[model samples]
Target: TKSQKIRAELLFKQFEDIKHVYYYSLELGKIFSTNYDKDVARAKLALWYNKIEEYGYDTFTTVANSIENHYERILNFFVNRSTNAAAEAFNAKIKAFRASFRGVVDMRFFLFRLAKVYA
Candidate 1:
């Protein structure tokens, strides 16, 4: 329940860009099947929404908007994750050379090499 509680807290704090909140209600044929308890789920969802609503924050509900997205979309979402990760790894290896004691290479020289790694 820690994760659920954390999620709930984040849900309230991060009421920004997330769209679409689904809450099911378990009722005797009011919304869903007579056997399924749809109203109960919906009640829980409403409770969550109410908690966040008190903060005067608002959001929208969105569904699957893309039909045939591809790997290029994933790259677009994280445009620089790959390059940045590589640069960080390379920087870690060269960090020792950055010490004032080492002074083996000029700071600008080291940075030039690092920049080339990313470029």
Candidate 2:
């Protein structure tokens, strides 16, 4: 909870002039695996394919294509780290460390504290 207000205030700054927009990207194979209606889901998957082509792509498409092209090992990666949780967790930890040093009321004491805590 150290410096939570400062963190929240900083986070709130990002939304100061925000605009709302909606964009959808889909993972059709996963949807179909547990889909309620087989026929409708299949049709929807086709529609999503068409929409993706219309919307085009960015770098992720290349990476996704690589995954499919490799197919053997990378599909296993997609299964395990389904989301980017590991990377996000590291970033969150670093942010917390930065937050704890916010006041830095005493440089000598702060350095000592940081060294003791992180050493």
The residue-by-residue lDDT of candidate 2 on 1-119, one tens digit each, is 76986775676567542211112333555543442354554455456555555555654355445544664453333343354677898678656876877765677886686677656
| Model 2 TM-score relative to the real fold | 0.28
Please give the distance, in angstroms, between residue 44's alpha carbon in candidate 2 and its true position after superposition: 13
Model 2 accuracy (lDDT, Cα):
0.52
lDDT of each: 0.43, 0.52
Candidate 1 residue lDDT tens string, 3-112:
98789768856764332232211221232222223344345334544444553333321111121133244233233323356778767766754563466546677778
The lowest-lDDT stretch of 10 consecutive residues in candidate 1 is 60-69
Q: TM per model? A: 0.23, 0.28
Q: How many backbone clashes does candidate 1 have?
A: 13
Measured by TM-score, the strongest candidate is 2
